[model samples]
Target: MKRLTAAAGSNLPVGPYSQAVISGNLVFTAGQIPVIPGQHIQPETFEQQVRQTLRNLETVLQAAGSDFDHVVKVNGYLTDPAQLEPYNRVYAEMLGHAPPARTTVCVSLWGVALEIECIAEVIDHRLRV
Candidate 1:
């Protein structure tokens, strides 16, 4: 079992613990705020936050040698339940047809409007690509 962390762009150990962890061919990402590269964690709109949150997820997934298609499940935590529709729409657009199984919950985000975490199975890249 190996605990995952930001591999390239290292940041302070924020909040409770590490950013991500991987074990037994599965990678688990900690809750990621919409802290895009060169951008603040705080964003102006729900749409922006949602995009950034997904981007952040993609970033970590890339670190794990996985992509959105490799994600088997996802959990979205939104500061506002009303943002569900827009979130779903955008998420669908982002991942195209092979959308991973997902669930969205309304919760109070610590410092942002949206946060998301996910579990992905690392696929054999050579076999596929």
Candidate 2:
């Protein structure tokens, strides 16, 4: 069987899935919503929720021993396509030049404001989750 490892674990997963899984040299993270762990924020603003979503993704990556710079690809799901501008600004600000190949589309959010998923390739061959 292939060994699978997780990055981070909050109180509980909103759905029946993992926050992230690591196999071989690749790490894949499940979509994250804007709702903060252990703290439910309702009527979350678009900008605020987007920032929080990235923050959550960052935490997962860190826990997996891989940072944003190691990310090779990202899939962004925005409830509204018009939000691309604002989300792009925020993502660029945080990600900087380490922009991974990303594809953003408008998808009805599962249960929250924003959702983000990513796959990263850690440069260091020494680390294998």
Which candidate tops TM-score?
A: 1
Worst 10-residue lDDT window for candidate 1 reads 4-13
Q: Candidate 2, after superposition: displacement of residue 94 in Å? A: 0.8
Q: lDDT for every model?
A: 0.74, 0.74
* Model 2 ranges with Cα > 4 A deviation: 1-11, 123-129
lDDT of 1 by residue, 18-82 (tens): 66677667778887777666544456777887787787778777776677888989998887778
TM-score of each: 0.85, 0.84
What is the alpha-carbon lDDT of model 2 when measured against the actual structure? 0.74
lDDT by residue (tens digit), candidate 2, 26-129: 87888777767667763356777778888878878777667888999999998877899889988998886878899998878666656889998644555574
Candidate 1 positional error at 20, Å: 1.7
Instruction: Give the lowest summed-lDDT range of ten residues in model 2.
Output: 1-10
Backbone clashes for every candidate come to: 1, 0
